[model samples]
Target: MTAFPLLDPALCFVILTTAVLAVAIRTVFAAVVSFIVFGLLMAIAWVRLGAVDVALTEAAIGAGLTGVLLLSTVARIAKHRADRGDDVPILEGPEPDPAPTDPLPGLATQSLAIVLSAAVAAALVAAVALLPVPAPGLVAEVGSRLSETGVESPVTAVLLAYRGYDTLLEIVVLLFALLGVWSLTADARWGGQPGLRHLARPDGVMAYLGRLLPPIGLLVGVYLFWIGGYRPGGAFQAGTVLAAVWLLAVMAGLVPIPKVSGIRLRLALVIGPAVFLAIGLAGYPLHGAFLGYPPAIAKVLIILIEAGLTISIATILGLLVAGAPEERPS
Candidate 1:
């Protein structure tokens, strides 16, 4: 029924190939790159399935942010090994042999892993095959009451209005995650900046992009947030854009990294969840249920919540990428 019949099959083929490559590749960097490609392809698949919100989320957090995190972790590990005078090189030349203590898994262990993977795949296929035709879903119910949620976009309505509790918890999780990252800071670096200070040449390409792209990225981020009430864009995608901009600026030496313990920084990190919780609690007294928005001002309330979440999400994501505080320069 699709307009591009071959397109779907081609995409699926490529996705499967990349997934296999991601797992089979010997180099960590190559595997990570393959994984990122797979995430991007999956985002496209979501779009094809007509879930634009999910597509945006997959592209932003799944591919973009997660890829960066993995790449950074790999780099850090390589550097740590090199600093310790291990045989491993720092991201260049041939990979060193695995440490004797960390030998490859025996054939029995490999066979067990293969069996478990095949069993899980078979179970998933059986479950899908057994699903009822037209699959039971709440589409009709959601559509019937969508107007009451005050958001034209069903995705936004579900996230910020109908199931606001889950959204609030997600933001709280991000706050908690950032707290966990901060906890890794050493006593000597307890109040220091959250990331290493970059020193980029003023005339370099990175510096140029840093100075230029942030203004454009800021506009895009705001647009995505503002349109969420009526379209597919929302807080998570907007926050990711803003966070990337901040990270880019920092990496290009256009701005100094903020200290993890700063009062302003802390406020920025918690304000979204705090605002969301306060509004949800107020709903109980006003509408007789938690997260129940009264008809007249429901739109306004949703927008306010999204605004708060956008700020908090952006700050938390940026800090998460920046990581825990590092020792101050002597």
Candidate 2:
């Protein structure tokens, strides 16, 4: 029995150790940085395991996008601390510290959480190490039939054509998450000057970089979207990259967020999932199953779906970063 070199057990052991150390450390910044490294290593493991598509997604979304999000949150929190003159208020109003009580209950809860996580991890390891290989038997059959489908990649074909419903549902899940986030901060107005006032300055290196980056990002995003049918790129991947550039522009005050979301913004945010669902429901009558594409127009439909999804995803991400119901230029 042989293990994939990138997926070597020893490498995984090292990753787990590093993650544990990061989590146990008291420094929030260190923990956030470690998570980013963990995401990159996970991508490497995926590539080694012969899942290039997943690896690309992990690298783009897990490492790149997530790291930015975490850093932004950290920056905001740090600024808040500075404004408050302290990170935590030590029971203000001259209240005396309560008599120290037994720490047993907190200790018990922490111990329980640790034990349960350890048990689950051990079980997962045992299952992976002991289970017989199941995918090898099916992958050969799938690969052989790949040519029969118009899509070049088996993963693409399966995701876009054979199991489109799953993709459709996943988009719905994304929408719901956005809605949930919106709900969480419903009353909080997102538009105002960010703590980084220098970001609004126009004459510095930041302005120069902001002026230069968006067009390049747009081209790269379009290229990724077009090439995804046969390559590692896709709508979701492209959208995230594009969103980051958009976010940069917003942060640098080059592109001001609108106070009220315009018709175009609203449309872009909903069009992808709406079109996908409409097509899926329509396919039941026309194609005999939900999300089943017609023979002559399947490729066209997939492209259309991907395009809508890309716009929607990018808009949602931008809005998330804006953290406002309607962002107005500062």
Candidate 3:
């Protein structure tokens, strides 16, 4: 029904090819690069499917933040190997030769893996094929009650109003995950700045972009949060952008990594979920239901919640990528 029908099929093919390459690639870095490409392609597919909110989230978190995290991991692994005098190249070329003691998967194990993968693929195909024609969904229901949610964007409304509890839990999960990472820090390094301090030449491209991009990125991130009330932009995407901006600044040596124990840093990490929970509790007194916003000021409440969430999400995401503390506090 649309122009350029071939576009969808072509995109799908590329996506599948990239996915295969991501898993089949010999080098971890190459596979990660392929995975990032696959994520970006998936974002494009989401856009073509008329899910712009999903597309933004996919591009920002799935491709951008996740790719950076994986690359960081690769760098760390390479550093560790070098420290141990392993002579293994983590990012470039093929993996180091396997130790003679290392055993490859046996023929039976490989066969079982192949069979399981095929079974899973067939099950997924069956599920899609069995989906009802016209595919039952809550589009109409969400539309009818959209105004009451105090957001013009259905995706925003669903995330912040209708399924707010789930969103809250997701934030909490991120916090917990970050805590788990922090717990991995050495006792001597506890409460110290996260990851390693980055050094870059002041005249280099990274330093130049770090100086140039933050102001623009800050504006865009805030705009995304504000526009979410009426469009396909929201806290998650905005936070990811802000996180990337922060990471860039740090990597360019424009800003120092904050101590994990810093009061302000800790506050920024919890403020979002705290605000959401506070609002939810207040709703019990105001509307006899948790997370219920009073009709008169629902929009104001939602905006407040999103603003807090944006800050916390950005902090948590940046820290997640920076990883556990590696240096003792000064």
Ranking by TM-score: 3, 1, 2
lDDT of 3 by residue, 41-85 (tens): 999999999999999999999998899889888888898888999
TM-score for all models, in order of appearance: 0.92, 0.81, 0.94
Tens-place lDDT per residue, model 2, 1-330, is 355555488779867976886687556677778888888888888887878889888998888877877877877777666697864522222223458977666878999999999999999999889887663455677777665546666777777777787888887787776666566443444433222233567887777788899899999988888787787778888888788888778777787665433677768789999988887787888789888777767777778888888888887777666554532234
Writing each residue's lDDT as its tens digit, candidate 1 over 93-178 gives 44565567876799999999999999999999999999999999888888899999888999998899878989999999889998
Between prediction 2 and prediction 3, the one with superior TM-score is 3
* Whole-structure CA lDDT of model 3: 0.93
Cα-lDDT of candidate 1: 0.90
Taken over the whole model, the C-alpha lDDT of each candidate is: 0.90, 0.74, 0.93
Query: Deviation in angstroms for 29 in model 1?
Result: 0.7
State which candidate, 1 or 2, has the greater lDDT: 1
Model 3: residues with Cα > 4 Å off, grouped in runs = 97-120
Better candidate number, 2 or 3, judged by lDDT: 3
Predicted structure 1: clash tally: 0
Q: Return the clash pairs for model 3, or none.
A: none
Query: In model 2, what lDDT does residue 107 have?
Result: 77
Q: Whole-model lDDT, candidate 2? A: 0.74
